[model samples]
Target: MLSEPEVAKHCAALLEHFADYCEQMDEATRGYVVRLAWELIGDQMDRPSVRRTRRGH
Candidate 1:
């Protein structure tokens, strides 16, 4: 399992790449790119540790 900071860093990197792809992609291809990103992030977030937040006082 990744630590919180590592997960955040990876998410940022994924967003950066997604933004770059979105810029270069044509309108028709943009949806595919967005869907691909959504799937990737969704998969990561589905992990148990990442899905739950610590309880607050």
Candidate 2:
């Protein structure tokens, strides 16, 4: 398994990539991407942090 810091770094990159991919799509496609992202984010909002602990939560 990756160390906590390493996993966080990778997830950050992936989130960036997801945003970039959405931006590059046509308006119709972008809507789908945005909706999917929102769904995933909403599903996790109340869950404990999956990333490393820091000075702030």
Candidate 3:
């Protein structure tokens, strides 16, 4: 089994790819991509960390 840190790293990489996909996608597609990203991260990471806004604003 992968360690927590390894899973976090993989999630981060997937988030980056999702960001890239969002940039190139239409509005509807971007929204879907973002939702998929949120679901993936939520499943893999701690609830508190995953729930925080990305910008920390």
lDDT of 1 at 12: 74
Put down candidate 1 lDDT per residue, 4-57, tens digits, no spaces. Answer: 788868977977887977878898788676656666555543456755456989
In angstroms, how far off is 15's CA in candidate 1? 2.5
Alpha carbon lDDT at 8, candidate 2: 59
Predicted candidate 3 versus true structure: per-residue lDDT over 1-57, tens digit per residue: 225888889878878877767677899988777666756655543456556446755
Q: Order the candidates by lDDT, highest first — what do you get?
A: 3, 1, 2
lDDT of 2 by residue, 1-57 (tens): 234777757756766887878767899987676555555445432345654334965
Top model number, lDDT: 3
User: What is the clash count of model 2?
Assistant: 0
lDDT of 3: 0.69
Which candidate has the top score in TM-score? 3
lDDT of each: 0.68, 0.62, 0.69
Residue 17 local lDDT, model 3: 78
The alpha-carbon deviation from the true structure for residue 48 of candidate 3, after best TM-score superposition, in angstroms, is: 18
**Measured by TM-score, how close is model 2 to the native structure?**
0.43
